[model samples]
Target chain A: MPDLFVGVDVGGTSVKCALSGPDGKVFHEGSIPTESHEGPEAVLKRIGDYVTFLTNDIGGRPAALGMGLPGLVDAHKGISRYLPNMTTHWRDVPAAAILGRQLGCEVRLLNDVRMATYGELIYGLGKPVNTMVFIAIGTGIGGGIVIDNKLRLGPLGAAGELGHQTIDPTGPLCGCGNHGCLETLASGTALAAEGIRLMLVGMAPALHDAVDGDPGKVTVEVMGAVAEQDEPVKQAIQHAAFYIAIGVANVVVAIHPELVVIGGGVAKLGDLLLGPIRHDVRARVGRLFPVDDIRIENSQLGSKAGVLGAIALAIHGLPA
Target chain B: MPDLFVGVDVGGTSVKCALSGPDGKVFHEGSIPTESHEGPEAVLKRIGDYVTFLTNDIGGRPAALGMGLPGLVDAHKGISRYLPNMTTHWRDVPAAAILGRQLGCEVRLLNDVRMATYGELIYGLGKPVNTMVFIAIGTGIGGGIVIDNKLRLGPLGAAGELGHQTIDPTGPLCGCGNHGCLETLASGTALAAEGIRLMLVGMAPALHDAVDGDPGKVTVEVMGAVAEQDEPVKQAIQHAAFYIAIGVANVVVAIHPELVVIGGGVAKLGDLLLGPIRHDVRARVGRLFPVDDIRIENSQLGSKAGVLGAIALAIHGLPA
Candidate 1:
């Protein structure tokens, strides 16, 4: 029988796990509510339980396990250095050690975006590319960079912070404490904020009506839905796209990645987000590069990216 | 006897060549006017003649010859795709073929910035680091990225066109035909233009006096000299530094290089250019990175970087 690997994506609200065969095909998948409020240890217990349940259903123990966490992870030491929404007490948690002990196998930990990029490179759209930049524009922006087909996890593992790039020097401060970060200008939260601001200004009447006059209810999805008919919403999306393009163009000029893959919530808006970005990139990139040759693509793996990427990490860590 | 190599830096006005031992020490160097107006063939002849002159000066023909050109270069095919300063007929010229036949040795061709980057990595400040970004802020800005200790020459051999990055979507058009490029705002030409503008507006009285009322005489050096006493010139330099910081900060977030080395004519102003850039970069980088950890330093090799880098290229291309 072929050995299997278990991949887990630990998120703020849920724990998504998948069982994959040696070739990286997901044979079984499951998710469980992350009862983080119960405590960090309890959350770890729940994740272990989910992993066991999946393994039992598959009728065997996996060869190894891999996990992706949404935070600062010390992958080499197998520690969760800092993770938001995973409980305050979770800081400096020896996550991989505990998980490895629970599952009776070695486990590897990695940043969520890095894992996702690895998955994409090995199994998704990045299959044949040597260099790529992956951007996840959700409530906040996150990114991973691949150069020469290897994930670029800098010495501090803080490399590929694309969202933190300052696009507007005088713009608002970002949660990361920087002013005018691309995330502050182009992420899902930025679009929602733009929507709320427009609604408050009485400019997005359609969006205002969609949320039933509640300005606070303006979300990126709501904005995306009403974007076609509402000029304000469309403009907001366009505005976000422009700043995002600046960030992307900056990367293009600096790294010259063959492909740029964008994922996460805002990417669901499809061409609405990508169109303006592509236009701005082409116009900005101009003739300096074979700008036309660079492709701005959407992630194919979607929500499963994190979990599958964890699997890729497991496969990568396997002793040859 | 130690083996020697000849390195050439082909430029618009003159061709610079140097002879160096395998250790990369320069033993002999010379220059010859390109006289490009005589046409592309004449320019190529001049380069070959210079190479022969340098080899003769060293009393021996080098083992290999390496050349760094100013534009799109097909390093693999040894073709000069498109060089800005060279004549229009120079496009698609078999640079390596013609030069190799004339010099009676193996030849290699690379973009000027790429060769310079390799030179720095092996023989200069980049010796200890694995990842770095090299920027040459001259009449125009050009850059080279070294990731995992290898230069990233994108597929088209145009990966590090840092000057062309658009900082403002609606700003002035660049020589590259893009709008608001960092080059448009921060290059030496931009500084001179800013000085001239300040002179025209009567905002820089010192600069006006320095240039004798001829705005065209306002060069980057003149601007640097007048910058301290002239508020307008000082502001112009500050403005350029701010935009340059944006470009550098953007690279910082995207590539996370261990160091950034600045070279070129503007860099000669030393702290005058680097100080503001460092301050802006630190302020912009903020918490995402240990802002203090990333160092922005000056190029130690300076003008000879081009020739030395070409020599490094010859050594790099040498077979085991």
Candidate 2:
């Protein structure tokens, strides 16, 4: 029997899993409720049970498994040091060893964003390039850096925290207790806040009509929709794009990645967002880079990027 | 005979050369005028002449010769694409090949800051650590990133241009034509400009006395001296340190290097400069790193960092 790999992306909402062939072609995929309220042990057991079920359905034991976790993961130690998005007690879990023992197969673990970036590199737009920077602009901004086709996880395993970079030392305070972090200026949460401010000021008439003037309904999606017709909404996105471009330009100068892949929820805005970011980066970077050679692309693998990257982690023979 | 490596740090004014043992121990070093005004060909020939002289001084042909150049260098192509600080005609010079042919040995090329970073990593404070970020805060603020003990030169071989990063979108014009760049706010040039402004406003009495009331004499060193007692000069240095701290904090979050090594001309300020930078980085980096494990150190090799790093380029073997 050919070796089959299973990948699981653990999230606050649900657990996403996929089964792929040795070549990374997905044969089956599924999701299960994490039920974290039941506690850490229960969630872990459910994950193992789901993996077992998937293997059983294929009528074969998987050769290996990889999981992406939203936590401070020590991949070297195979432990999830702190899972902020999960249960309070989900600390220092020896996840890889437990799952490996449960399935009698090798297990690998990765930070979800890093896993998604690896997925994009091996299976998405980044496949054509040797170096790329992947930014997931969602509720908060985070990034994964690849240089010379190798993931750069520095000594502290926190090398790619691009969102936390201080663009303005005196700007708004970020949730991370810092002032003027990119996340404070350009994240999905920031977009929604800007939309609400516009709505309160009655500048977002189209957005008000879209959400029937409900303040809470002034969401990121509502702003994205209003951005199609409203000048205020468009201006808000452009403002965010301005900060994002500055961040990208900084990353470009620091890493010189040939390609920059934008993923996560905000990337769904597509060219509406990307065009401005590209122009700003080009303007800021100047002769430092060829500028024309740096390609800004959208992530092609969508939500499956994490799972596929987990599979890539398993297939790449694990990190040692 | 044991292998000997020759390292040449080619500058517009002078070419500094060093001979080192196989283990990167410097045995001899010397310098000569570049006379760049005679043009690229003459400069190249002079460099060859210097290499020949160094070879004769060592009484043997070295195993390999390495050079560190000031501007955009394509190490893989062994070409100096543009010599910004040198003669206008020095473009796309196959310097490694030309010097290797002149010396009859293998040769490697690297950016000057990158070469210094490699030297620090292999022989200085960075030797004990696997990852480090080296910043040369002098006339301009440039940086070199090392991940997993390997220098990360991205696709364009132009990564680690930390000085050009725009910390403020509307601060000051940099030599690169960008506004609010770290270089514009924190470089020696910036410090001098601030010092002159303070002097012009009569805010710097001590500085006025130090420079004998001659504004033109108010240089970086004069400012450093006045900073010992003058509030205005101290404030100027502190302000520069604030912006520099922000840039370093941003890098700390992005790369999380185990050590941050400061080199170049301005680092002569020692603990006075390092103290504020460390405080800012620690406060900003916070939970991302231990806030303590990330040691911000001074470059031990000092002025020879570039030449020794060029020697490191020869010892670390060629980039291929």
- Going through the candidates in order, what fraction of the true interface contacts does each contain? 0.70, 0.64
lDDT values for all models: 0.82, 0.82
Off by over 4 Å in 2: A1-4, A21-23, A35-39, A86-107, B1-4, B21-23, B87-90, B97-107, B315-317
TM-score of each: 0.92, 0.92
Fnat value of model 2: 0.64
Error of 1 at A297 (Å): 1.5
Compose the digit string of candidate 2's lDDT tens values, residues A184-255.
999988988999899889898999999998887777777877797889899999999999999889888887
**What tens-digit string does per-residue lDDT give for candidate 1 at B181-248?**
88888888888888888889889999998989997788989888888889878888888888989899
lDDT string, candidate 2, B1-320, tens digits: 45788888887688899988787788888999988788777777887787777777667668998888887888888889877777554688888888788777888998888888888888788887877888888777888888766887875567888888899988887767678899989988888888999988999999988888887887877788878788878888888888988888888877777888888888887877888999888877785446688888788988788898898888776444
Worst 10 residues of 2 chain B by lDDT: B282-291
**At residue B106, what lDDT does model 1 achieve?**
86
Clashing pairs in 2: none
Candidate number of the best lDDT: 2
